[model samples]
Target chain A: MTPVLIVENLIKTYPAFRLGPVSFKVEAGSIMGFIGRNGAGKTTTLKSILNIAHPDSGSIRYFGQELPGNERAIKQRVGFAGGAVDYYPRKKIADMIAVTRSFYDNWDDEAYRKYMDIFSIDPQKSPRELSEGMKVKLNLVIALSHKAELLILDEPTSGLDPISREELLEIFTALKERGVAILFSTHITSDLDKCADHITYIKKGEIVASDTMESFITGHSIRGEGRNLEEIMLHYEKEDYREKFAE
Target chain B: MKNLLNKELRLSSHLLSYLFLFFSIMALIPGYPILVSAFFVCFGLFQTFQNGRETNDILYSALLPIDKKDVVKARYIFVCLIQIIAFILMAVLTALRMTFFANATPYANNAMMNSNPVFLAWTLLIFALFNTLFVGLFYKTAYKFGKPFIAFIVASMLTICVAEVSHHLPGLEFLNTSDRLPLQFMLMFFALVIFVFATIISCRIAQRNFDLLDL
Candidate 1:
């Protein structure tokens, strides 16, 4: 199977943060877990992939074509969801869907409709009235409906509850089975445990770990007697475990 | 281009902007300071541009299958659409008012259609030239600063200032209206040429700036 995404030595530097000449590839139909601490450059890396942030150097290729600076052409086969899914409070879901579908030549109207049904999204309802969960669900519905070969989600489960999260994961599995590759970016390791095939760990603007999920989780573990998950993640994350692995 | 225009219209909220356009145009009856409303009506097209740039607005549009150049081109077209509409409304009012003072002999609406096709032609030529320069420069500037209000203010100030001067300043009191027509024509002709040249240059600058846009 061909790789759906191939990023080579990408770099983005700013006064406060920096990102790579990082390189990696995601095979079609595999779900790659993109994990990092809160400020670990996960979003920056994803933004680079989307062509939302221009890279300082290196290359990115999607479906074997070099990504141009133009978002219109590079983005059609890709469906993206992030904190970036901010919709106008008054915008009706139907209008957004129709407008969005008009832009993507490969969009699947049937799939989108199915997700709209599954998510219980009322097309007539204004997005402002929806709960955070409902909004996230709607964003997913939009992304899933597009028949995207490559899905790049930045913290897709941010505000989702367990039930909603599980349901979303189930849908992700279904899509993976249909040959869609997914880059699931999240800090929640629990989510990765369920859905990830490969994991890439980013730290301080560089990709510190890029390996299969089976190998990544094997490299570390969280053990605690009722400690907060965030605390444990911070504990190991602060120690630079990847350096130990290198040793 | 049509697809882009149609989609942009929808993005600006169908029926809403059109309503705004309707009311704005209605305010352009030239006799009673109504022509002043043309500026606010021009705001309709600019607002549409603004709506597209709101928080994640670019993210969604960036996902479309069209070219970015076409996307920018669509914005230029929308500006034209609004400008044409605003002019039509103002022209009609100007014609209607002119009729109030004219003879019983029937005459086609001169102000709206330009009784002298030369003036209409020249007016259209100059206005288009002015507008194209304004849009090309201001659109890219908007992208750079992402501040529509400032860009709007600057473009509005420049266009109104220039247009006002051209409208009132080209004729001298020392010369007869008939004799000075040639001199006025020359002034208008030079203005038209400069405006066209400026617009072309502005569009070129816009193209290059977008290539290096931080986003």
Candidate 2:
């Protein structure tokens, strides 16, 4: 089956930093967890995939169609939410939704209401009135309302309580069951252990590994199925610190 | 593009920007430069950009399905709409001064720039300069506005001074009189051309700069 998203040898450069020749794939009915330390070019890679940050050279396709010429049409079927998007703190949530809804033709008002209820977001309140977890939930509500086939979320579980993180993980699992492809980036590997079918690990703007979660743990010679993502991340990151100390 | 404009108006625009449209009425005052009315209108539009930056409008819009160029285009259109609205009001006030208030002693003995087509032309020129300096420079970073706005203030104050000083110059006295209809229309036409041409150039530059921007 064709993957929901394919990014090939993507590269973007800055005066002091560079991201890529990074590549990854996200298949339908699956959740791909993108893990990287801060400033490891995770956000840049995500933005490049969305073309929010222009790439110097690469190929990005969604549903087997190139993103360049078919941006609006393809994006109509995709939803992105995270740090890059912020509400007008003074504007009501309903007002923000109205503006966002105007851009998508497939918006489902009933689905929006259902998510709002599940998330406990009050449309009358502004973003300033919500907690960090509530804000993430609100972002999820907007994404789900449009019946998005693919959801690209950045750090949705960051700054959330453990229970809230579990609830959000459940939502990702439910969405995957419904065949919605998800690509989320975060440093919290525990959340991935619960929901991610596949894991893509990045360090210093390079993909160190990309595979099924179980295989990733065993393939690293960690020697047990019971071993988890956090242990694996720690095992690799420790080597990074050793290399830095040696340098 | 329409959806983008609607988003700007509904989300990014500040209420004070709309209320400031009333500043165009300043044209009715005698012994005043009157061109300052146009400056206040542009200042009102400045608030919209300010609100956009505070709310992360650029990143939010980039998240949508539209091209980045369309985002820049929508803002240009919004600025033009506000400017055109103010221009229309100022034009009406100028007409009132030329007709019913033409014989009023305050205007007749006024030492300042009078309300005439020349004044309208200068107003358009001010708008043009603002678009060229303020809006064009803004897209270079798409984040900072204070420096670009300061440049616009300096340029506009000079423009207003020049317009006021023209009436005091020996051969340029006709610019303040209502009787020089043919010349005033010509000046207005020339200023209109500058307004359109400068704005188009500014938009093109803004689009290119914004396209090069990362966010």
Candidate 3:
């Protein structure tokens, strides 16, 4: 089966930092947990895939088409949710949704209404009135309602309570069952431990590891027992730091 | 593109309404067409810069399934709409003053109206120049606002000063007289041509710059 997303040799530069030369792929019907520490280029990489941040060099293929060249078409099938809803703060939730809905030809009103009911989001509330978790939920509702086959989220669970996080994990599982691919960046290792089928770990702008989550855990296991995602991440990060300083 | 334009207008609707009200009040103050024009130009510049500073709007727009060029086009269209509204208001006010208050103290000696078509054409050219400089510089940088804002103000003031100086020169004195209607009409035509070119060039520069912008 064709992968839902393919990124190869993606590189982006800023005055203070540089992102790889990184490569990864997310197969259809899988949850790919993009795990990284703060400023580890996760957001940069995600943005590059969408051409929100133009890459210095790389090729990104979404649903088998080159990005930017196929940006409008690719984006139509890919839904993105940042850490928070950065929509017009003064506009009502209904108004914001209406504006977003107009841009997508595949927008589903029933799906939007379903998520709104599940999330308990009031259509009349302004963005400022919603809590951070609610804001993330709002973004999710918008993304999921558009019939996107691929969902890319940045720090999606960072501000959520444990129960809300669990609910979102359930939603991701349901999406995967429906053959939708997901690639979400997060520092929350436990969320990945519970739900991620694949893990791609990035450290300071480089991919330290990318493999099946079970393989990743067993490879870094202590004795015969597999380590949790957090312990594995800490081990790799420390190793990278020691090697850098030793150089 | 239509959806993007609609979003831009919705985002700036409140500010646009405030500007309309302010211009309406200013229009009643008889002898300051130049001041009114300058304020209209500056307000347009200010609104664009202020909107650019709203990073949330930029980020949100980036997520939409549209090309960066479409985003630039939507913004340019928004600026044009605001200008059209301001100019129509000013024209209506001028007509009112010319009709109902022609003999009133402030309206009786209005020198600006002696060459009405020329003054109106000059106003359009000033707006076009202002849009060109402001939009071109803003899109080139995309994020910085202070320098572009200051540069536009300086350029506009210089243009006004040069026009005022020329109006007082003996060789150009006929420009303000009724006997030189044909000359005024020619100047108006020339200004309109420059206005169209400046607007086209500004949009082209904006589209190019925006396509390369990272966010």
Candidate 4:
């Protein structure tokens, strides 16, 4: 299947850290789990893909078109939900939806209302009043309502309860069934294990591994025993640490 | 562009309403034209900077499909619209004061208290200078808000102080005389040109800086 998103040699530098030369791709109808330790540049890479942060040097192709140059076109078909929902705190949920809805020509009011109803979000409530899980739900509602073909989320399940997290995974599965590609960065490995078809692991700003999720688990398992995604990630983390200490 | 402008307007609606109320109250004070003008200019500078300070807004807009250049342009356009609205309201208040109350006022002998073209020119110059400094500093610092606001406040106060002192100088005394109405009109035109040029330059600078900004 053709890839829905591709990042090649992406690099971004800050005063104290650098993320870079990283490459990955998400297929059109699969879930690509971007797993990394804290401060491992997952958010930076995601931001670069969205052009929220300008890359030092790299190429980002969305649906076969180069980014920034094709930013408007690509962004129209892609939906991004960051880790936190820091929308206008003083404005009501309805006000935010109204403003956000105006920006997209393909915004589906029915989808928005459906998700709002499912999440039990009060349109009259201020953003500041919503719980952390509700905030994530609100972001998801905004993203999915726009008829986005690709969804790029950063640490989306971080604040959710277990049940909510499970429900979110089900939502992702449903989206995948409809051929909508997903690339989400998270520290939550079990969530990935449940829904991700592909897994890409990053350690200290570099891609350590990228492959089919089953192969990743099998390769990292011990003595012909199948290991969970978290154990596999821990194994890689240990290897990374050993290499750093060895040098 | 329209969507971006709409977002700005909606986000800053509270600030706009506050300004309207403050300006309306100031208009009721005797001999308040210059005070109203100064407040109008300063309020616009302060409010626009405050809007930019909201990190939520920055993050929200970044998620949108619009270019960063459009974000900067929309903000500048919003600032201009607010300034224009405030200016018109101030002008109407000044005209009303001059028509109905200028002669009945306690400061009847004070020509400086009269609403005239010369006062309008001075107000335009002060507002232009404030915007030029505020917008230039704001974009240069990668959209930092506090520093530019404080700097503009200080700069405006100093400008107003200098203007007040210059009113007593022999060469500038004609500013208070009605016989020099043509000179006042000429000064108004020049001040407007400066305002327009400064606004355009500020927008260009902001666009360039925002393009380089990393969210």
Candidate 5:
């Protein structure tokens, strides 16, 4: 079977930075973790694959076809969630469902209702009234409501509490069990530990490593000490981030 | 193309039709002929522009399996649809005012508010046609060059003014004056034919832009 998502030498150029010379692939029915620091091109690659950001070079194929800009057939099979999924600030969750359902053929009302119940979401609350975790959950509920074959998640778990994140992980695990593919990119490593089968790690617009998640955790160690992941990984990345944040 | 038009309609809250209707009422009031017409054209374009910004989730839209041509086609159709409805309502209102203005109100027949129906119809048609034409061009241009928002609005306004002005020029009055069925029918038919051909060419141009679009 063809891979669900594939990018080859994708390049996005700007005067200050370039996002690629990057290639990666994710097979159907598997979860791939895209690991990179902030501004390390994780979102850029996602944007290129989805045709949100036009690539200066290279190609992205989704399920064996070229990703067309603003095409409906490719969008039909793909579900996307990110901070970019935000909507009218005053819109209620119920209003969101009512509006979004008309856009996609795959919208499952039953599934959407179920997810809302699972999250205990207030149907009447405006989007702005929701906590950050609730907003993320709301985003996921809409993405999952449609029977999308591939879910492209960018920092999906960033705002959730541990319990909510665990719930999301369980949902991802269930989606994988159903043979859906997932491309999840985040700064959080623990989120990848649960469901990711593949890993694509990038640094400064280049893919430094791509492999099975199991291998990455088992074989990699920086500093050869019991230093926490944040510290050890920072050293390996060879960048001092201390001054960017106050002690 | 039809499907995308339907999608744009839904995403924009089905407001263009209502906007056309609401602004048409302004025309029949007969106190502000040119003001009413300009209001409808300017406000309609502005509202449509806002709708574009609101529904501008192009990346999410790209997930669909359709081609870039169809995507651009749908957008152009939406712009045209909005302009057409606005022009039609404005034309009818102007005609009705010229017919019934004496019975309506104190301000009805004042030269400031009065207009010849034939002339009004032609002007409205041209304005509607060229306004849509400009939208197709500007949408593609705006996305491609990342032009500032204010500049895009200015360009659209300039085009609307030009198309309306073309209808009012001296020699063009013959096309506007025919009251006989065959002459009137032929004129309207030819205008529509030209409008449609222009739309098709505009669609093609927009599609080419989408093909190379940086977004």
Candidate 6:
């Protein structure tokens, strides 16, 4: 089957920074963890994929069709949550949902209620009243309610406590089991160790590696096996630092 | 588009914008620059956009299943809708002043911009200028609104000044006369045309700028 998403030769530029010609694929029914340090272009890549940030030149395709020509239709199948539910901060959660629901023909009210219950959300409360974790959950609830086949979440687990992060990872695993593809960006590699099937590692605006998680760890580990994600990441980063020092 | 418009109303709207609709009542007051009512009404709409920037409304809308151009279109439509509502209110009050209170000493002796079609025409022009300058400039960054808003204030104040000064011109006094119905109606028609044309152009510019925006 065709992958759920494909990005090819993606390029975006700023006066002091550049991201691209990046390329990656997200398969159906799998969890892809996008790992990058801060300002490493992970959010830019995600935003470009979602067309929130215009790419300088590239093609992003969803289910084998170009996104530019089929943005509305493709977006229908792709749900994106960039951090928490912070917009319309004074509006009740239900009121915000009422607005969001109108944009999706496939919006599932039952699913929304289910997530709300699972997340222990009070629909009458405004975003300002929610904790960061609760805000992220609310954002996730809306993304999932539209019956999206693919989810692009930027730092969805950031700002959560350990248990909340684990809980979010569990939700990602559950979504994967239900055939929902997910691409989430985070610097927290330990979270990836727990749940990610695939890892797309980005550094300095380029993909350093993209492969199955187990193979990635095995290939990068000191003894060629058994090292955790955090260790391997630290090892590689230190190696880069040492190389720069040598230079 | 309807879905986007609904989103704009429900999520992007501010209570202050609705409350500012009451500013249209200022048109009924004697000896005042009636065009100031139009300015306040536009200011009200500006509040929504200001609040939108503060709340990251564009990013929120961008996340929705709509085209970026559609987001711009929806906002333009919302702004136009508010302007139309305020215009209707001004029209009604102008009619009230012309008929029920036409001979009232206060209005007849008022040396300021009086309630008339010419006044209404000027009001529409103010809306047109605000929408054009404000929306167009705002889209250039799609985040920082200060420059756009400042540009709008300057343009709108200039429009108001010219409008207030027009009736005092030697032969242009008819603009202040409610009795010159045909000329006043003609002026209103041309103003309507300018308003519609300018707003459409503004929307097009905003759409282009927003499409290029990274946020």
The candidate that achieves the highest lDDT relative to the unseen native structure: 2
The superposed Cα distance between candidate 5 and the true structure at residue A48, in angstroms, equals 1.6
Instruction: List the pairs of residues colliding in candidate 2.
Output: none
For candidate 6, the per-residue lDDT at A244 reads 82
Q: For candidate 1, lDDT tens digit of each residue in A92-176?
A: 7787777767666777888888888877889999888787667777777776676678888889887777887887788788889
lDDT of 3: 0.77
Worst 10 residues of 6 chain A by lDDT: A232-241
Categorize the docking of model 2.
Answer: medium
The pairs that clash in candidate 4 are none
Q: Rate residue B168 of model 2 by lDDT.
A: 92
Evaluate all candidate structures by whole-model CA lDDT and list the values in order: 0.64, 0.89, 0.77, 0.76, 0.66, 0.88
Error of 4 at A4 (Å): 0.7
After superposition, the stretches of candidate 2 with alpha carbons farther than 4 Å from their true spots are A83-85, A222-226, A239-247
Q: What CAPRI-style quality would you assign to candidate 4?
A: medium
TM-score of chain B of each: 0.61, 0.98, 0.82, 0.83, 0.65, 0.98
Each prediction's interface RMSD? 2.6, 1.4, 1.7, 1.4, 3.7, 1.4
Candidate number with greatest DockQ? 6
Q: Which stretches of candidate 4 lie over 4 Å from their true place?
A: A222-226, A238-247, B16-21, B24-36, B111-114, B140-143
Error of 5 at A236 (Å): 3.6
Candidate 1 is graded, for docking, as acceptable
Deviation in Å, model 2, residue B201 alpha carbon: 2.0
Q: Give model 6's TM-score for chain A to 2 decimal places.
A: 0.92
**Tens digit of per-residue lDDT, candidate 6, span A60-124:** 99999999889889988888776654888888889889888888889999999999999999999
Clashing pairs in 6: none
lDDT of 4 by residue, B71-170 (tens): 7788778777766766676667767765676566443555343455556666666666666677667766555766776777777777666655566688
In candidate 4 the C-alpha lDDT for residue A216 amounts to 77
Question: How would you order the candidates by lDDT, starting with the best?
Answer: 2, 6, 3, 4, 5, 1
Q: Candidate 3's residue-wise lDDT over A202-232, tens digit each?
A: 9989888789998888877944333788777
**Per-prediction TM-score:** 0.79, 0.96, 0.90, 0.91, 0.78, 0.95
lDDT comparing candidate 5 with the true structure: 0.66
**Higher DockQ: candidate 2 or 6?**
6
Stretches of candidate 3 above 4 Å error?
A222-226, A239-247, B12-14, B21-28, B41-45, B96-105, B108-115, B177-179
TM-score of 4: 0.91
